[model samples]
Target: MKKFDILALGELNVDLLLNRIAGFPEVGKEIFAQDMTLTLGSSTAIFAANAATLGARVSFVGMIGKDSFGEVVRSTLEQRHVDTSNLIEVDNAATGLTAILNYDNDRANVTYPGAMSLMGVKDIRPEIIREAKHVHVSSIFLQETLHKEIFEIVRMVKDCGATLSMDVQFDPEEKWEFDYRKILPLVDVFMPNEQELMAITRKATVEEAVDVILPYANVTVVKMGTRGSLVISGGKRFHMPAMLNKSVVDAIGAGDSFDAGFISAYVRGKDLAECQRLGNLAGAVNTTAAGGTGAFSSIEAVKEAAQRYFGQTIEL
Candidate 1:
């Protein structure tokens, strides 16, 4: 058996969230009326933290600067019990960071790739992959220089007999025009939100988009936000409803938390329906707080919520 349940590789950063007031400010005009909060973010970091909190022995592999932000990331992961032994510190590059502005549930984010982009395929250690039951790749485009190397690493994980998963983070600046045709076949599970799926397949409907991308992987899960998620595998489709919550504070990183929940359920050999249910619970729980990972819940809490709302145990 593998020593670790999941090994996550990708970006890590601190997020500064700014709440912008309604009405855009006039060009060249200064307007100050709103609020802000500093938070931790980065797709891979959040997912790994959630997975570790959910009782998966997870390891995070990525690069960070030898700066205060890097220290914060390290401390946050340690507090969450995520393995950071494989994390590398880059000497010259600064740590990655993002500034997000939100208004009435909508948001605009400005990101700095920094040291996160410095992660290379050479940075991955084979021994880590060998010990992990599953390998997850997040924010592939941020490290544009490492696309081929990341694909190679995924292939190596397959060769080592571990399941592989990937989160497609679409950046308009860095368009995802890669040959997913070649890389998708190597993945066991492929996860993307509705918008990302639409962009990748150029399809109008979610079902159509799934049909177009299904051939590339054994299983495809498309997160549909409030409507929950759609899971397709072996030509069958299953829909899970989102857990109802009174209020939602933040939606960022909810998908990553869903990924962690789904993968954790998968590693436990849960059925497809159960996986989606747990995923929805995880996503819903995350929105109860203000930041990306602020509301990440434990496996016990997730299960209790599942039983309370869905009238089902988390068991497969």
Candidate 2:
């Protein structure tokens, strides 16, 4: 049997969130915030943690520095039950971090791409890829080396006979220089938010973008905030409504949580529809907590939150 059900291969970082700020800062001035929080960050880490909570045997394969932030990343993943044996630690660079300034419904972020940008194809091991039945890759743009070598990484997974899912998180550069036609065929599932999909495909609408990628994409899921998620596979399409959360603490890692739910169900042979439902439910649960992983401490916690907030029962 495979050692892990899912292997998360992507960026790892810490988030320093400053909330309730007085106002936007001017060029030479400093502003103070009323609240602050330091926590593990990165969409891939969120996915791996939540999937492990959902009862998937998850392992993480990412690069971090031999620093305090790296310890935070490793310990947090361990606390969440994700295997960290594959973590690459290097002394040359410091761990990456993001400073987020939150204001009401929106937020601004500045990131330091440290060691995460240094990991590339040379770091990935075929034996590690072969140990997982499925592999998940996210936040391509944030990692410079991984962004340039994504095709090689995906091909490696496929060559290991492992199914792969990719979440092309927002490209900070906005260049969106992805070769979708060549890459999508290797990706079993393509997960991207609506805006990301539109931006990547250079299409004005989600429909147009979907059309552009449908031919090459095997299974594509478009996450539309509040509205719902759109799924397209084998020439069929369906829209799954969001499990609306009226009192949202934050939407920090909702998309990653959705990915965790969907992929967790997927590796267990759940149908597409069920996977979508779990994704929506997991996303809703994410909003009920403070950060991306606050609500997902355990499977029972997720189940309780799902039932209490959405009145839905989650099997996983």
Candidate 3:
């Protein structure tokens, strides 16, 4: 048996979220925010934490700087029980940070890559990959400089007999342009949101997008917020409706939680339908709080939500 159940690789950051007023600022004009809060982000970190909370032995592999933000990132991971021994601390670079602007249930973000850009394939140890049941990669853009090295790392993990999962994060800055078709075959599971699937495949419909990408992986999950998610594999598709909730406070990290939920259910050899339900429950519950990792529900809490909202069983 593998020593770890899952290993997440990619960027880590501190998010400074500002809630802007309802109206947009005019060109060359300034607008003030009503309130704000600082939170932990970085997609990989959030997912790894959620996975650990859901009962997976997980490790985080990424780079941070020797700064206060880096300390917060490490502290947050430690609090969530995620293994951070593999997290590299860069002496010269500053930790990654982001400023998020939120308004009327919508949000925009401005990010500074910082030390996250410095992570390379050499940072990954072969022995670590050999000890994991599953490996996940996130935030492809921030580590564009190390794409070739990342590909090599992914190949090595697969060669070592671990299942590979990938989460795609689109960067408007186009710091890196990913060829999904080229990378998909190397991954056992390809997870992306509806918009991301469309953008990557250049397809007009979700079904079309799935058809184009399905050949690349054994399983593909496209997360559609509110409406739920679509899971497809071997020419079969399952649509899981979103779990209805009363109120939503913050939507950050919901997708990462979904990834954790799905992988948790999946590693246990549950049916695809049940996995989607668990994933949906995890995502819906995450919106009820602030911050990414902070919002994730416990395994029992998620099971209760699934039973209460969807009248479904979350198979262990």
Candidate 4:
């Protein structure tokens, strides 16, 4: 029996947020931040937490060090009702962390990859793959081992009779070395932001990028922040407009939240149009709070935020 509706095979990290900085850092200069908040970080974690809040049976499979940061990652996921039984704790490295310097409407991030970069295809067990109805992986470039064995990882998950989704987040090195022809055909849903899509396809525009991948893509969803999203499958296309919020906060995990909403609806057999709309709504809601999981505290809170902020009722 499948114990989980979704298995988020992604990175686990902590966020060290620094707000109201004196000024941008210079090579030889020093500046101090006025505030600090250390919490759970990583797009996959946000997606899993929000999916759990949306009433999905979610579990996380990732590697972390047997340290305090790892403890933080485990406890926080459990608090979000995400099963962490599949988490792997390695003693060779520490948990990953991203130090975020929050500015007015933008931020600078420096990530310490740590154990998050260590998860490999060999680390994922077949029994755990059979426990989930679907699998979602994000931040391809960040995970060194996984990136090296991408095809094998996807093949393993697919062979287990579970569907697969992947959000190939920005390639930090700008190499954009992913082979779309091989990867796209295996992925049930291919999620990416506008920039990532363009980069991966080596195209200058979104249309150009879509044209290149259309041949191999099964279900492609392009997340255009503040501009909504695009849904493409077979020969049909849906352009989802953004649900703008009046009082906007930082957009830390908006895209991940969008993935959560989209996948949550998708797993429940919702049509692509509804999934795209819910994805847009969830992304909008994410910007109304401090961080990715803040606006998605619980199912009740999510419904309240949707009703009160965007005036939409969450079907879940």
* Candidate 4 lDDT over residue span 51-130, tens digit each: 99999999999999999999999999999999999999999999999999989878999999999889999999999999
Could you tell me every candidate's TM-score relative to the true structure?
0.89, 0.97, 0.89, 0.97
Error of 2 at 120 (Å): 0.8
Clashing pairs in 1: none
> How much lDDT does each candidate structure score?
0.81, 0.94, 0.81, 0.93
Badly placed stretches (over 4 Å) of model 1 are 19-36, 297-316
Q: Which ten residues in a row have the lowest lDDT in candidate 4?
A: 243-252
The local lDDT score (0 to 100) that residue 34 gets in candidate 4 is 93
Q: Indicate the worst ten consecutive residues by lDDT in candidate 3.
A: 171-180
* Cα lDDT, model 3, residue 139: 74
Tens-place lDDT per residue, model 2, 1-316, is 9999999999999999999999997899998899998999999999999999999999999999999999999999999999999999999999999999989889899999899999999899999999999999999998999999999989999999999999999999999989999999999999999999999999999999999999899999999989989999988889988989988898889999999999999999999999999999898899999889999988888999998999998775
lDDT of 3 by residue, 141-186 (tens): 6675556565676788788898888887776664345676667788
**Candidate 2 ranges beyond 4 A from true positions:** 27-31
Question: Candidate 4: misplaced stretches above 4 Å?
Answer: 26-31
Model 4, C-alpha of 4: deviation from truth (Å): 0.3
What is the RMSD, in Å, between candidate 2 and the native fold over all Cα?
1.3
For candidate 1, the per-residue lDDT at 281 reads 80
What residue pairs are clashing in model 2?
none
**For model 1, what is the error of residue 195's alpha carbon versus the real structure, in angstroms, after optimal superposition?**
1.2
Let me know the TM-score candidate 2 reaches against the reference structure: 0.97
Q: What is the C-alpha RMSD of each candidate to the true structure, in Å?
A: 2.6, 1.3, 2.7, 1.3
